[model samples]
Target: MQAYKLAEQALVGKRNADTVALAMYFVPQPVSRKDGFRRTVNIKANPMGFATGSNLNFDLGLPKLMAKAKPVFCEAFRLEGHYESKSGYPTTVSVQSDSDGDFKVVSMQRLFPNVSQDSLQQLHGELAQQYASAIKAGIAKLEMKTPRVELRFMHPIMIQGAGAGSDEASKLFQAHWQQGWMEFKGKNIGLLGAMKTVADHNKNSVPACKPQVLTLN
Candidate 1:
């Protein structure tokens, strides 16, 4: 599967590299049926405008970007590749690996220590409603037979293990994450599960999104 390949790639030069983060969404329909459902992966080396911290986070700018690029998916599978933050830094989320092939994420219920979870959930619900309205309007304008799309934002953490003494800090820091794609058929779905995380500055591992079939009607 795509997740397996991405995990392998993350470990290519850096052995300890384990976890990866991803943001899944939809893209514009392709030109032809032959192009519909074909998957692509894009590497983002530029830095993003998101703020960093212990938990996954997002910036006001991200939604603006999404609003500008309204994507819809009918049906789509997953794909993988290298990507980085818009700020030219590593992928957003980072964490410590509890064991091989398994990682923990900051629970959605506890994203911000100061804010109550109920309030955050309510806020996200409102946002999703607004996004859904916008996405519906956007998708309505597309031509029939426009294949669904899955636009992903990939963030992988490639760091040097403690005591390795590689002295290639710049090269390691220059390491990248991925943005990926996929497509299919449907009315288009929208769901917001998690925001990307910051680079694992403490040499901590990050988290990986398990491949899943997500559909929003």
Candidate 2:
């Protein structure tokens, strides 16, 4: 079966579980542009309830399923988004990076049932390893049509504060912004990484805020 088809099927199977929504193959154009690449493909599989604003989360087992099936799909596409939640939401398993080279998983939220901190970290590490392996294998076989594209995960601070046009309230808490980016086989990856580091420094140097902005890139 095709990789996307397999991913879609896996997503459908997982959606039958509790409040779980899966969005597979999310290719953001801005991310591509930031990395100096243009993507012609976008693939995704979002769980049904997410669009309706239902409280849906991913089944913890879905990653296992995705891992098992990813070999097939990764050949044509790169997996992105929260493997454990919907877009812009907190999740125990999240995938980021564009379709070309770099990808990272942030399993910060212990939202999965029966998941411990140690176990979550272990899972995160394992997923990262597996994804790297899959991507390498996929790239070896596939033909990249466009100029190699990298993804720059933007910091909310870059788009907010001082000259960013954000309001006083946003600028006041801009120090709380955190960001990261992955460099595919393209440029600006280093720029994005530097931005994230600077943002983290700014956040840490300032006094804590009561309610700070937490934007994940």
Candidate 3:
């Protein structure tokens, strides 16, 4: 029994190593704020997904393993959310990886895409309706039926990797941490825990198995 349990744990670790990962340049957009409590919503739209099946050159993007973001729907359930572009950039936002080791900036680019004012106006109109519809329905998720017409025009910055070594990657990550630049949705979670949550979602196909507040201690 002991040997079997050990083997099982190792197997689980291996599976997570491949399926879980981190995002750079952009992260998940959590909608629905509260007075006190906070909830992380895993939406169904990511940069890679938007780029994929389209002519958009977001190849600096770490390709999303799945074709579509699967927001787990619930009636009493909170909203399923995904990532959105917060900043397009000449900044240091990078796609971090740890398959072989920790703190590797897998890819990045100097400049991210910038949206045009006309497109922003269009986005404002679409997003206004999008949020209003969700709020009116008393849910916190974007409806799939509605087209995200705005994104087609709003181009985000490109991220290209420089092929840094593990040590250099670790140093870069450390600098970000010291500067308080890195953020994880869960209060006490970090990169590894976040990926573990991703793996859990991949393994379990139920709402109960979703990634919630996690603490690494």
Best by lDDT: 2
**Per-model CA lDDT versus the true structure:** 0.26, 0.31, 0.30
- Model 1 per-residue lDDT tens digits across residues 125-192: 55445444322322211122222212221122211121122334223322321121111011122111
lDDT of 2 by residue, 68-103 (tens): 444222221223233223532222233333232123
- Lowest lDDT sum, 10 consecutive residues, model 1, at 178-187
Clashing pairs in 2: 19-56, 19-57, 20-57, 22-45, 22-47, 23-45, 24-44, 24-45, 25-43
- Comparing 1 with 3 on TM-score, the higher-scoring candidate is 3
Q: Scored by Cα lDDT, where does model 2 land? A: 0.31
| Quality of model 3 by C-alpha lDDT | 0.30
Highest TM-score: which candidate? Answer: 2
Q: Candidate 1 at residue 172, lDDT?
A: 31
